[model samples]
Target: MYGWADSTAIEVLCHTEQCVVCGDLADGFHYGVRSCRGCNAFFRRAVTFGMQFSCRRGGRCPVDKNARCACRACRLAKCFAVGMDKKAVQPKREGTNGNGIQSQDNSFDQNDSELENRRTSPYFDSVQLTSPESTYSINHSIYAQLTDYTPLRSPSPPPECPFLLRLCYEFSEVKRRRKCMLCKSLEEILTEDCSIRDPATAEDFTVVFQTQMILMFEWVEKLPEFKMIHDPLDKTKLLRAFALRYMLLDNVYHTYELGYNDRLVFVNNNYIIPGQPSSNFNSCEVVNEMEICALMFGAPMQTLVSELVSIIHGRNITIGEIMTVRRLMLWNPGSIGLSSNAQAIASQASNNAMKELQQYLEQEGIEQSEQRLEFLLLYIPALTKHTKTMYEIVRLIPSFGKMSEWNSFMDDVLRGV
Candidate 1:
């Protein structure tokens, strides 16, 4: 007998703590209850199904000491009165680590300790956003912002920062000016210089920063062994979008080195088209292996990718159109220019999408539209990566130049990789 009266029915006897909702002596049954059966039942219902009821009159509802259970709303308040810990409610599972795994102690505190280590980690410390504002407490904001994805957060930082940082930010205006430029070209730069300090309202800029964090957590969630393995080399690369940030800026710097002395390439002024130049196929686009390595260091693996897909499909996307609009405007500067290459790609994508939609025009084929959109989105990037135009345009940019002096530079980045 753990101090309960109705032995067969299991009614816990009340000590000094009475049910806050009902004056009846409470038993320790429902959610650390000290209330009556009605209140206990209410709490159990609230916890089990997540009912959100509001008092029509106001917030304060009465609770009687004897014949209690006045208002449904009052019962919930009583729950808080007795101290049901909200923090104790575990966060829902988001995704797995890079290795597709999880552990028993999935507490926020434990995750914070891990992030703190990566922050202080020598290789990553420089880029770890130590600006006190970036340091967060264990709360809803942190979880809402970062930890849900673990894989990308697991790796050490790239070693080529301070210099790389200086190089990328030098031509921030180009991103603003190059509205009609080839999208693949612009996207390449975005990916190359993804690690540059986030720009004000820049689409790719925000995506790079956000992706870095999301991928980091996703990386951890995917790989269970990442917790046990201290070796930094085992991590997958960051998303190409993020890696391109540094790579793109590096290419711009190389452009100056290559004597492509057109200031229009890097400045805020637009380059006028003389005529549609014939696409060249044989050019070698500079890769900036160092930045790519850094990008690789921060990439999310399979688990995170799956989670992101789930997040997008889980909600009614139509309601979030406004958010999508903002993201597109930020990332695809070409959205403002009808003639921009991004718009062209978008148009091409739309056409393909229309073909996918045609399948559902006659019947209950709506499900195929979702699948079609998904496959197209994934496939588009892969297809775009292989274009001759992309290769030519990327080569014209400077960062693609051969890094004769990369041995030392690479050594630095590899120290953390």
Candidate 2:
């Protein structure tokens, strides 16, 4: 258990890395406190002009990214409450314009030179602040630009978010890029053609499995947190912990998204329909004289499907929901074997992703959204259990048949454990 000081230190470290005014990613030390560029600008404007503000809500309003501009009084009050020093506002710095005339930069980033000097110190570790002439301010413009090229599917999510969008685009890109033997795109499956595919033969399963592994590698490479982990061993360990879980969830959800709630789906055009309780198989559908696929998939996989899918299906989940949840799965900070730095990245990224998930729920107007969020997070444990089940299923693959050429990848995946 943590003592008060320890807990307080932990809390401060977390908050220090985030903007105290509004919980967007911190740009750097702003007015003597860590804050995002937008909040830094807002505070400078408020303090420089000696602007006063009034609250219509008894001076108690939530000031987050979505509502930072909503309540200026509470926002300014919260700024001081969080130790944003008004005294740090230096007189506006002027630079020579194109006309050779000195003009003040309108961007109101107080103490720019000081922040610049501190940026190289061990204390500050965030993206660089915007240059005075760079016009990109609308709360999350920098963050939003990360996902600006990612085309939205439908019913766009809210909270001016990026994690949600980037994750979805990654999933879509991974799924869409893989085509059939005929070179047909799978994008149509999400809308019009999610027909239940027959169980794959051993060769088909091998090909699909190999394809998914490659896709997962590609997708993981694109993630910001994954890129931050510098150690090869840590990267491999994180991927090992996440690989089967990601493939399973992606396969299942992809299948579900194609309008099949009662069955578990896989890409490369195959799926697994749950069997009736106390059932028998021909021992010929997938493996060589072995009741593989659904048989080995068994009770645990069924529970994973029914429990996870029912909630998602019943609740009418959005693209944001599964992708945010996948982000949590991918960068689980508590996942064993990560180095301190890798784990720190995981922890911060996971927290931000969870916060975005909550923000998504609130914007959806879900009744009791916080409680619903708890319900969503509960699946994280279930996902772990399902991943373990997948390991067991993967172990069974070797005994089923003889395709040493096609089976080497699976063998390599299981190695060095």
lDDT score, residue 220, model 1? Answer: 29
Each candidate: what lDDT? 0.31, 0.57
Candidate 1 has an lDDT of 0.31
- By TM-score, who's the top model here? 2
Question: Candidate 1 lDDT, tens digit per residue, 1-417?
Answer: 111212221121233233444545455445533444555544543443354443433433344543233344444444443344433434334566779786434343355335333322232111112232233222122222222321111233256433222223322322322211211221222232322221111122222222222222322233222233332222112112222333323223323332333221222211111121112211324345333322211232122222222233433332112112222222332222233433454445445334423432223334455554465345334322322222333322234333212222122222221
For model 1, the superposed segments whose C-alpha errors exceed 4 Å read: 1-17, 65-68, 86-417
Query: Backbone clash tally for model 1?
Result: 56
Taking all chains together, each candidate's TM-score versus the true structure is 0.19, 0.53
Residue 260's lDDT in candidate 2: 68
Best by lDDT: 2
